[model samples]
Target: MRSLKILLLSSAFNGLTQRAWLDLRQAGHDPSVVLFTDEITVCRQVEASGADLVICPFLKDRVPEQLWNHPQRPVVIIHPGIVGDRGASALDWAITRQVNRWGVTALQAVEEMDAGPIWSTCEFYMPADVRKSELYNGPVSDAAIVCIRDVVEKFATGFVPVPLDYTQPGVIGRLQPNMTQADRTFSWFDCAAFIKRSIDAADGQPGVLASLLGGQYYLYDAHLDSRQGTPGETLAVQDDAVLVAAGDHSLWIGSLKRKAQAGQETFKLPARHVLAEQLAGVPVLDSSIAQQRFNALAYQPIRYRETDHVGELTFEFYNGAMSTEQCQRLVAALRWAKARDTQVLLIKGGRGSFSNGVHLNVIQAAKVPGLEAWANIQAIDDVCQELLTARQLVISGLTGSAGAGGVMLALAADIVLAREGIVLNPHYKTMGLYGSEYWTYSLPRAAGSEVAHKLTEECLPISAVQAMEYAMVQDIGPRCPHTFDLWLSQQAQSALTNPQYRDARARKAMLDIQQIERCREHELAQMQLDMVQNRQQFAEKCRNFVFKRKTCQTPQRLIAPWALTYEAGMPESRMLNG
Candidate 1:
């Protein structure tokens, strides 16, 4: 198909939107983004874009009638629902309702949200016990991409879309109301499945509110446990997660957000940290002892296992935001893995997100946010240092999207392998951070000075394919998590016998440790000014992130190309479509 001008309108440049943008651009389409600000601004930007197609991949706001009624341009909404389905809480309701199948629909925008003529649709099996965000990021996103590609193909062929028809087979979806706190609420007295499903349905958004220790709190990031205790009572604490007993079994609550009281602000934090005072008397589950006593299902963010000549160290931090304690724990794990007899070390990140740097919610909730921020950055730097000087050949498996220091942390490995379709944001300007995961050492070393500079200064997200083009990553793996795991294992095993890889490892060991140390110190010094001194208002930005404050307008960098035209008061004479 000939290259077409496309305008992507989204509430935020979220994972799905970023993926869609990257896919379209890589497919040779001219695409630009316009974040939702307000009805007037959105309409104005749509008019000014003059795009041949408008794709709202991840929008929350309604499409303005002005643009939908326009004769020349066609507006498509990538709804995370099947045909005949409509609503904002589609995923949440699906998870809560335990639907066996779910899908994504690409349809024309109309006055009614998610109720329009369907351009294309793709369905997939709904995996059991998946969180709402995970469901969206995994199968739903994949299906949406499939539908999007089909939409583009059909549009190019001038094919007409079919209107929603109830009589059509496989059109079983219906409108679901916006989920409420009451819909998500569940008691500890409820069965483990019920509680887990409820919490999973509300994961990452408006969390499930429940009464705990005489205080109201919102819960998130749950895992099942077999241990038994009094229902509704705290059993134990381990790795900042609290074990709470359910009717049938126990659940490990990884994070909690205290419901804000009058004149108070609250954000999500590790459950143990949020209820430190209340959990002071709770028995702590030692990971080392538990590893020997129980199965591998014990609640722990970081885990290590050796198979043959490969040692895999996996960490699944909540939302991939590592706190000071979490970072310190990972540092210990890296040290342990380095001391193992394994020939290769595979550092696999979580499925949700690899890592997004320090935990902003934890930093914002600290008594001294600056000091906490400083400690968090230093702790992560320690992990990178361990990887930089490791004896074993280090390989990072990025199974999910990562941003800021997280991108650099992965670069610390000898070979960085990123999953296809994962987005990597390698800059820290948005968070008002200089960043200190030894990025100054890792980024330029991996991708050369020019590419590194462009990545950091531009503050834009790059696709995994783009990262490989820039030499930021050594290879790209399959998008499927299971397939990627198998591929990563094969690669790790193969590297053990590859003379070229061994030679690379030898050269990496010969690097001047002094220069790397100096780079780290410089990065830390800059971070100190930003974090401790608040030179760039890191505190404000951190709060804005944790508090979910929306940006007043889309960043100029995102819509930079059209900014000049708008400034000059130029008419929209097919500026982009032409």
Candidate 2:
């Protein structure tokens, strides 16, 4: 490879270009910078760094006529958007379209914006919780850095431009032409797939808009309900959830923005409140009145339906608050079922919830003196190990919300079944408790570390479809009017009679594997102790903070652990007071 001089053109400060220039210089190459902006920032910075500088107009529209004429050995443009999605407001355009994946392309400068052949591309998947600004500020910035590195590597090896493989199928050609004002207007009747795609594309950018109470609101995450209701009628609010009616389906507005007198602010209100307010005086339109409709929908009883299938057992979890005793009872029942040659276990919650998991408030309040906490954790770990090692195919039938411990329990199952509207949340971090019960291993194994980290660390909700995509859920089914009973019947038949069912034999093998690899008694006990101590300290800190009191002085023995765990590398003032 022959080294050559490199020049970069960018309108705004390009972190990639700057970093690449530094890397090139470190590697003994001559690199220069130019700005398309009218300001002298790039020129001054380039001159100060002993590099050449050039001024040009914007690179997107005038690149062919104006900017590409530069004589630099290899003139490169760092496109902030994905290669196929290059254009002005590329990031904005992508967000408006709800694209799940995006990339940055380092291409040779051509007359048209982003028309040059690609040198290299780096891509990243967008998370649902990531805001529009974050996509540009984080992933987009990271993309620029990647492009810069590619450009620098190309310059080191003698600049050879490679054209984009347009002949390849699925290569998006041509930029998105600017949209008219009319084209930007929001439409509620769009097909579910299109709406979902558009929402994902626009994620963390801008462009998705909806009219709510005469104010324009940017739509973030939304769900389509096939159940029809009056268009624009408010349905119900459950805490921060807002339900609204659309043409063909009801739209559950998980989050919303309203214009405040001061400025635009987002509100996290329940869908029920919005629904009641909007439809207060209107005649109840649906065949089922909202009260009866909602109640009829909320609590549906489930019965255990036995099947002869080797890997299928169908049972329903009753609708009610979760208790530790109930969890223990369920575990015992599963053990009994396992002893009876049950190979496939399907546990579904009644109505709108699978299980809320362990009650956080209860766990927090339980003064599990250090030793007891460890003992409890060990017991929980045993249950988790049993679930993992069960000979039968263990599946969670999730019909409603599964939160925190509930999600972990579902994860313990080999497979999970969910209705489309089920919501899964890991609410541990928010409550300041160190997550335990083997979820640390089970969650990452089920979903990739990146996703698991986001769920555990940020306390984000995972929808059933998203969960399915992440391998968190295996099957998605619709609720039968007779409830999941009929569904269970079919599932049981499939499990008991299916010639291919391997769950019984599989369970024995899994148990043997667990005995060898996931010994539940030893490590789990210690982990539980650690979790309990951490939670106790965390609760103390939170209580102190709430009461405007300082944290209690740490005992000298405890100080060592505190420094090792939470206070390492902190200054004296920031360290725990002893």
Best by lDDT: 1
lDDT of 1 by residue, 122-177 (tens): 99999988998888889999999998889888888898889999888868999889
**Candidate 1 at 315: error in angstroms?**
0.7
All candidates: TM-score: 0.96, 0.39
Provide the global lDDT of candidate 2 against the true structure: 0.51
Candidate 2 local lDDT, 1-578, one digit each (tens): 34434444444322233344445444555544444433233222222332222222124334433334545433456665666666666655665666688777767666666777677677877645343444554566556656666666665566667787667775663477654334445455654445544544454334366676556665554545555566655655432345566656665554443333565334322222333465455443221111122222231122243546533333223222343433454566556556655657666565335665443322333466344344444455555666776766666667556776677777777666676444577646544556555676667676778888887776645566678788777667773424554665465446544453344324334444544345344445444544555643655543443233422231132112222333344454433221
lDDT at residue 67 of model 2 (Cα atoms): 33
